[model samples]
Target: MGIIKKIFNKSRSPEDGIFFEEMRKILGFNPVDLSHYRKGFTHRSSNKTDENGNPINYERLEFLGDAMLGSVIAAHLFKEVPTGDEGYLTKMRSKIVSREHLNELGRDLNLIKWVESKVSAQHFGENIHGNLFEAFVGAIYLDRGFTYCEKFINKKVIVPYVDIPKLEGKVISYKSLVIEWCQKEKKQFHYDVFEDNGNEDVKHFGVRLKIDGKIVAKARATSKKKAEEKASQRAYFAFQEKINKK
Candidate 1:
């Protein structure tokens, strides 16, 4: 009986056994160090700390992961679009790693379901999905090195969604595009932004986009930047023909 109990003890650890299986499904391979992956899902609200009193959360890992993703994407773009200039390559990479795209990827993987947080997940902002996704990438790099990191990204990100021709016309930032077009066409453009507090829980900002001293578009959003972008997008559509000609 003692020998039987000893054999049972040597089997899968109860603490991380199920988690290991779930991670295997996501990663397509068994992870050697589960701690890294745990950290990837840890939230700052947990108030965890390392032995050295440093904060133990996914923020640092998110930074590393962002860099890794960018590097890998840049490399792939470089090889795939040999004729693409530096500016063109940069724009393509930005579209691939945009916050919106990252959020979509995270939601598709349902990564937020694994987060260990003291706060309720509903209280978390939309960016949490993208942040967790980046931290996961960071953890993969630390656990299995660059080769595996590249493989995972290529399988999950590049192969599935990165279509060069489609991405070439993708507008990651309408605000930037509008500004570029205005500069090239020598048009005088101004964004008249003001606080537009209404009967809402959150304060909002309104923006009126004027091109060549004429009101092209007006919009309101929760923040100034968002309001400006919203106005710019409307303005872009309004002047799409002229802008496209340029």
Candidate 2:
């Protein structure tokens, strides 16, 4: 009876001890308390309430993760690129933490598998991975604190990829660059975005790039920004030789 009672007692812990252990393996750190990590992966769709009857989800965790990511990335860039000015360092950090890169990282790690949600995962957009990644960072901050968070960022983000020269060439937004050039050259520019009746599961926007009252390029994409950027990029390339000649 004593042994049986002990086994029952072990089974009644508020913490999912086994799950926590597995999570430690996954995160490469023994979480001091499981609640932080648990809340990190908790999707809003579950509509869960905490002990205080307040909503519980990964949103707050995401905020923390974003800040952690930026801090660590900034530190790394500052030390590595001593010659880089403020704008250069900021742009490099932005490239590393950009939504596209974060999404790719989260997807690579299959981070969403642990998310507790009432909604189907398939229904979620690509941005979910990036959000989950940020939430995970927040959880790490709450669980093990900043030192561990810095280590994780260094191991996962900086050491493997961060090529300063290559990052400098990476285009975060071609549309912004083209627009700036147009403005500088005193050329009128407009991105005429309109809905496209296309044969596809998702709705798409079509963008026409006009410069000095002439159509330079046209592109279509699932989002207005994407379409405009595509058109702008194309226009930039098409007129690159001529534009640089001036």
Tens-digit lDDT track for model 1 on 67-172? 9999999999999999999999999999999999998778757789899999999999999989999999999999888888898899878975686755877777
- Screening candidate 1 with a backbone cut-off below 3 angstroms (N, C-alpha, C), the clashing residue pairs are none
lDDT winner among the candidates? Answer: 1
Give the winner by TM-score.
Answer: 1
Q: Which residue pairs does candidate 2 place in steric collision? A: none
Off by over 4 Å in 1: 1-11, 170-246
- For each candidate, what is the lDDT? 0.86, 0.82
Give the Å shift of residue 153 in candidate 2: 0.7
- Tens-digit lDDT string for candidate 2 (1-246): 653454345553544876666676667666666778789889999999978999999998899999999999999989998999999888889989999989966775567878899999998899999999999889899877899999888877775446564588766667888988988989999889999956533567999999988999999866787688779878877887776889
For candidate 2, the per-residue lDDT at 92 reads: 89
lDDT of 2 at 84: 91
TM-score of each: 0.65, 0.62
